[model samples]
Target: MSLGDEHDGQTRTRLPEGNTGDPYATPRRPARGSRSLIAVVGVVALLIAAIALANRGSDTPTGGSDTTGGAGAPARSAAPTAASGVRPVTGKNGEIPTGYARDEQGAQSAATNYAVALGSVDMFQRGPREAIVRAIHDPAVTDGLVKRLDDSYSAAFLANVGLTPEGLAPSGLTFVSRTIPVGAKVKDFTNDTATVEVWCTGLVGLAGEGSTKPVTSTWFTITEKLRWTGGDWKITGSEQTEGPTPVNGDNRASMADDIAKAVEGYGGFTYAR
Candidate 1:
């Protein structure tokens, strides 16, 4: 079964007050002249100039770099939605991504993709499940982790989830368990270790006519503590928790056949952060 189904400021600079007469002279009846007005206008102009400068800085093209504290310089902290520009890794260990860059972005990318692999339908099976565990987990824990996962996908557990002892769905049904990561964030990072949280939505169940377990969607977050091992990011530990779920929509649910067909027709993605 998919893990998703189970687990789940600002400083202000003071502007100069307009040059008023000396404090003693200020006691003279407020000047009727435009000195006060001029000061006000000057202040307004300065504010407008400051605002314009800020706007220009915000509008600078992201591709340009300004090393001299110019408008074109990138912000010290990137906007949350800004892309990392890291491409998806080209290497695959049995369809799981490998060879992640040794950086925070790479850690996030590995955590996201590893979550997908661990929550996959293949995890309900034996051979593919073992392969997945070995590929994504750190070498120090691979053997023990594989054994633990094997026990978790026991024959009775498979049967409970509407799968056969061998992890197959009944003749007419398609078993679906897929996790799609919505986004990833780094919780902590260092040169050799990183902790990432992957928010994901998944579907897990049997899809077909008269299937006892109709495919349903779930939302959850998977937190993976990863270590840089053997020149790549590998999961050292992981946890899942229930979602930041959205309110259910009013759209009608699709039929079993349609859901089954869609599952077969659509392909899952390889995620990057």
Candidate 2:
């Protein structure tokens, strides 16, 4: 899916009104004007000095005298880094990854990984799609979502995207559908539930000789409301919206064979934090 565009707005500043009686002011007023100018300059100088001092502290090396214990910068606390040191899940429920932790970081990791699973090429196939839905979604919603998605990816929809009724690409081509999460955040979270938003960039289409549906990239955000169940985070619901996209770069597009080769060569990551 693709996102809509955003427009930038301009800002204008108005200057303060001039003193009306300035033209006929007394000669002594010139001294007052000088005093005022000096005051303003002093304020500016003070501001510059303060900024320089602040930046100097920031620029100091970790090994400097200011560091605690003079060993280096203070060790980063776990609160900010959130390093549990727990290994990520190495198992998969069918094609979808499984076994997420039960914290805010766990919720974020689950959401990002689920987004990748749901956006994959396998989601077009009946068996794999059902497995994925059952794997990622909460048990309460799995059946409903599976039925809805089955109806949504109908035969006509498959044909429109140049896929067979069985959801397979033609023999000569390889279908490409993969989501790469750029980042994720928890919008609302508690011990039992969380709302997570994942920003992702994806590639979708067919890669092959004379391919009309050439691979293309898109940006979007997926918001998943998750529930902690079965000792893991499972999505209760999800909605996608257009992205905070950037302007396209000047890089030249690659050939279909190269695209196919690259997809095969580079594997995707299991995201965290």
Candidate 3:
């Protein structure tokens, strides 16, 4: 996911000093591994952002819709969208769940599920990548989209990120890429088409002993253009933008084994609106 690019976008923040004798009063420089982790995570973040920027369709907006008052419209509240008591989807297209209702709630549900599929570690592999694209994308755009994604995940790019050409990690290492949707809301809805925004936080990197690229978390929002076709909602196109990122908290990072174990222990959910 990262190539150790020469981008220095990290901002170092210092916590307030408690007391002169306090051990935390004097901040120490991060270890060499910590520095590498930060740099690699930044590179991958930029890489994903660049991909989203390039793949965006002409009709897609560069940002999420503004909730503030505009064009004489009343200001919309910033509160989270209320759930509509919709149940989780009961159908499956391969491993991906399908069979969404034709409404705003269904559109939001589709967008969130698609976001998870798009951000998964499976997307790195060719076989699973094709299955995911075919399952979730509109049929008319599926082949072209698959080709584009394959090109994006070329062998050289995989090598740069410490994975094999087939997207497998080295011996004794585990690759992790998972997207957890924070929330989803419909932006525009119609009988056959809808636009939805899904806010997500994801983990992406390798995890294991002596792994230089430790797993890292990132926040991003994905905008999906969905069309109700073939008895289910399918993606026409999508875009992503860097987050409504929160300030970094003062928590110590966990060990790589712990991350790898957690990823394996916990299962993902079938998100619903």
- TM-score per candidate: 0.71, 0.69, 0.72
Candidates' C-alpha lDDT: 0.59, 0.58, 0.62
Number of the predicted model whose TM-score against the real structure is largest: 3
Residues 1-273 of candidate 2 have per-residue lDDT tens digits of: 000100001111112121100000001111222232111110111111111212222223011123345565585322322333344454656545567666666677788778777766677789977887788878988786777667756786576566788888888887677777777777998879999887877676677897776666766677788999987889887766556677989999999989888876666666655
List residue ranges in candidate 1 displaced over 4 A: 1-85
Ranked by lDDT, the better of candidates 1 and 3 is: 3
Task: Name the 10 consecutive residues with the lowest summed lDDT in model 2.
Answer: 19-28
lDDT at 34 for candidate 1?
26
Residue pairs with colliding backbones in model 2 are none
For residues 211-234, write the lDDT of model 3, one tens digit per residue: 766666767777788999998899
TM-score of 3: 0.72
Report the alpha-carbon TM-score of model 2 versus the true structure: 0.69
Q: Please provide, for model 1 over 184-252, each residue's C-alpha lDDT reduced to its tens digit, 9 standing for 90 to 100.
A: 777888889988887777666678999766666756677788999988889777655557778889989
Q: What is the lDDT of candidate 3?
A: 0.62
Clash pairs detected, candidate 1: 8-242
